[model samples]
Target: MISAGIDIGSITSKVVILDDGRIYGSKIGFTGYNAERAGSSIYNSLIEELGIKHENVNSIVATGYGRNSVQFADKTYTEILCHAAGAFYNNSDIRTIIDIGGQDSKVISLSADGNVKDFCMNDKCAAGTGRFLEVIARALEIDLENFARLSLQSGKPASISTTCTVFAESEVISLIAKGESRENIIAGIHDSVASRLSSMVYRVGLNPPVMMTGGVAKNSGLVKAIENRLGTGVLVPESAQINGALGAALLAAKQNYRQ
Candidate 1:
């Protein structure tokens, strides 16, 4: 069966096509004006790229903060469930999952048999999320894709004490004017972001062999900082951001095939 998943996220939307239980194709795009437009665009991309006729797709499911906005999806699910489901689908041995998205972060604990046992999320703040980094990068007149590259070149990261996003942005600007190197500033941002995220994981107590998901997982510098804080390595998937959509697609396939 050709089942599909569409995840309309706050910052981006993703689509996945699954044939039976295996993913056939997937697409990702930044969210435009509205969630509906984002979902439609991603859906069209997968259909064209995979050369799959629209009606040939058996089922569709949506997930993420904007899941309910996907009018085309047959069902909607929370990003929390979708992330855990996707992680289990990819690697059943996964003990914990860390999903750092544009505006929030979550740490999920799973049983040995691939079920969610516990989870913790930092949703109200931008201090430790991808959106935080993006704002800092914008202030620095640097590209989001280049934040890590510049940060990794620093000799030492400057200290940022505030957890409030507004206060932190002001602190970054003050540091920049105080003869701090661009590299140092960027590194400091990463440290601050990682510090905020580590607090959540510490509070939740995830087991080892943790997998990193969501858009921020693509950031190598943040991943390294998180590892440093936790004293353990994190597994990052190549398709990190799309895992929620993949899970939604998998669930859709199961439902459709069973029916």
Candidate 2:
């Protein structure tokens, strides 16, 4: 059966098609202002790119912050469940999932059978999130792509004490005025993010074979910082950005088979 998953995140929308539990194709695009539109656009684009007819898709599941916006989806699932499933599908041994998305961060503990045991989320503030990093990157006048790389160059990361994003930005500006190196400031930002997330990780109980998903997983510096704080290695899947979509697609396939 052909199944599709749509993830409408705050910053981006992703669509993945699966054929018999295998990835057929996937696409990603900015979410823009209209989440519903973004979801349809991405899905449409993917099918067109893959030369698949819309009717050929047997089941569809939507996920992410704007998941409910996909009116055409057969059903919607929480990102927590989706991420857990995605991680397990990638590697059954993964017992933990750290998802740092554009606007939120979450740590999920999973059972060996791929069920979600417990999960904690940081959604109240931009701190420890990609948005926080974006603010810091802007203050340092560096592109987001270079933000992580520059942090790795720092001999010593500066200390950012605040968990508030606005306060942290102010602190970053102060550091810049004090002649602090950009690399140090960047590294400090990563450290601050890691520190904030580390608490959540422990709150859910750190489990081995941790998998890091979401947009921030692509940030090597943040991954290293988190690894340092946790004293363990974190795994990043090849399709980390669309892990939720993949999971949703898998769910779609399962639901389709049950019917």
C-alpha lDDT score of every prediction, in listed order: 0.85, 0.92
lDDT of 2 by residue, 87-158 (tens): 899999999999999899999999989999999999689999888888888888899899778999999999
lDDT of 1 at 145: 79
Q: Which residue window of length 10 is worst by lDDT in model 2?
A: 250-259
Root-mean-square deviation per candidate: 1.5, 1.2
List, residue by residue over 77-190, the lDDT tens digit for candidate 1: 788888888999888888889898877889888888877888898967787877888888878899877877787888998898888888888898999889899889888888
> Model 1 lDDT vs. the true structure?
0.85
* Clashes per candidate (backbone, < 3 Å): 0, 0
Q: Which ten residues in a row have the lowest lDDT in candidate 1?
A: 250-259
The superposed Cα distance between candidate 2 and the true structure at residue 80, in angstroms, equals: 0.5
Best by lDDT: 2
**Candidate 2 regions off by >4 Å?**
257-259
